[model samples]
Target: MVILLNCAHHVTQRLQKTFVNYGEAMMYSLESCPSPWLRTHSMWGRYTVSFMLIVTQLGFCSVYFMFMADNLQQIVEEARTTSNTCQPRQILVLGPILDIRFYMLSILPFLVLMVLIQNLRVLSIFSTLASVTTLGSMALIFEYIIQGIPHPGNLPLVANWKTFLLFFGAAIFAFEGVGMVLPLKNQMKNPQKFSFVLYLGMSLVISLYICLGTLGYMKFGSDTRASITLNLPNCWLYQSVKLMYSVGIFFTYVLQFHVPAEIIIPFALSHVSESWALFVDLTVRTALVCLTCVLAVLIPRLDLVISLVGSVSSSALALIIPPLLEITTFYSEDISFVTIAKDVLISILGLLGCIFGTYQALYELTQHNFYSRVNFTGGIHV
Candidate 1:
């Protein structure tokens, strides 16, 4: 995985160096490359990259929605008293309803409002606040995780093939930020120092991912929920951690939503008159937020959603695209056979992960949907 990330960074830098005038977006990298295939079908490449990016960003937004709902629901359910005669409304978290869907619906308007603020500078204020709260929340979570961890020998080091594929999807999802590489480098005041920043930052990120994942699994073992937050004890501090994390994720929705909006909304508004631009933008933003909410409601399994998203799109963006881009862009150069072999190997690994991971995730999702329908039908019959 680390090797793959390094490869991605290398390709991204090479792309930027190859095309100095283009913007720092993934689509621009694809469009501006000197590949013969892309030169002939540059527009197609651009649109493909754009579509993948849109899917990846919106998948993130949907995951955020489900994540917040799951954590918030757990917090509320834990906080409420266990009464045999408790009314459905009494069991409700925020709105006058029960279940995760209601929570998603209740949060929809707020999310719409947040994404409506299209200015990156304005959104950064929210991002700053979210960062602070997120740090605090992580501290609390780490405190929770490190306490009384059980023996690691009891747990299986390697899961079965299906679970392994799921893990691959989830892991890919975690590192999907590879798409941001060029943009971050382009924005850096000292672009020359970006390699240092990239390596340092990625090392820290990978370390944290390893620590949290291994520790969380060792701590909770088989009983771990989709999120570590849900596995938190039903105590005030931990509950507050859930809420704090929820707030951070809530604020983060805008930044994730920003990418797709920048792509789709403008293109959509282009078809309309100048007078309708603002209205169309706001409407489109609201509609997109609602779309994510709807997706969250439909497939409320946070873990599976993450895996599915990662496998379906994140794998392509993070794994498949970079090496292929490198190979294509540098085809005319005197590149070594070993370099081509390495690129092909990396691309193959990504393709296998994508195919297997996607299949497993979709299979689980269908099983979930099937059982849900059966239960619903049974309840109706009763």
Candidate 2:
């Protein structure tokens, strides 16, 4: 009887243990089961939201680029046709100071774009190169025009090949954003290997600039317009090139416009709905782009604008800002006096260029009406 009781007790204990283990297993199974329908629906909803967001952003970029195509073409066409003597009335009216303002204005979009975009390196490289190409072409054209001037005040300044070289060098100084490669240097996948790549890229750009400037100068002499596009031989080849250039310019500017709006939208969203913020941001950006395009189209003279931008806007940003930032930030480091001196010299050159170039443009503007004036003799004057 006692043995039976012991067996029964043992069985009871075993049953209790089994019951506890089963309960724990059941709980674990319940916890580990696939999510409920509501949970799955919520997760899918989030993914859908994310996908839609990405699609919307991409769609916006596409539409924006499409809208800018015509304007880009026009800019290219203008660049191709722009004479060495071309000057914009706005530059004349605004003066060098205004050039600085406009330069700042142009930069605003770039900065905004950088902040908004994911792949900034590509965008930056493209925009910088485009600007450089445009400006370089303008410089070549300007050189041609300056050479053509019968009694240019600074005739001796550009008379000899040596002086011409110096002038070209100065123009290149205005083309200074090549320093952008510096900031991007460390970002490369293999930074050490990139030195060769960077050097090669820069060499190619320098070579291209020299070739274009030399050819342009040879073709147009002193009468070369501000844009090399104008200097292009009016052959099928040239026309095709011009069309391509125009397309590039259009895309560059469109990207420029899109960048600012996209960046500002996020900031604006603090006070407004995402959609409304985007709308307002884009509206403002579009207005600015339209205004710039109108001015560029109406002004038509590439040289004057180029000179204005070169001397004032590009100079300040390219020459002034980087050195200043570098000095201020890296002052404690082993910076050389030579570097400081160089920065000062660059800044001075930029300032002088801005003043002199604007003066030239304004002097020209004052001498002639952009629109044809009718003479009393019933003849139209251009």
Q: Pick the candidate with the highest lDDT.
A: 1
lDDT of 1 by residue, 20-44 (tens): 2112333344554565575666666
Task: Please state the error at residue 234 of candidate 2 in Å.
Answer: 3.6
**How much is 183 displaced in model 1, in angstroms?**
3.7
Where is model 2 more than 4 Å wrong at Cα?
1-198, 255-271, 372-382
What clash pairs does model 1 have?
none
Deviation of model 2 at 358, angstroms: 3.0
Residue 300 local lDDT, model 2: 37
Per-prediction count of colliding residue pairs?
0, 15
The stretch of ten residues in a row with the least summed lDDT in candidate 2 is: 373-382
The TM-score that candidate 1 achieves is 0.84
Candidate 1: deviation at residue 215, Å? Answer: 0.9
TM-score of each candidate structure, all chains considered together: 0.84, 0.50
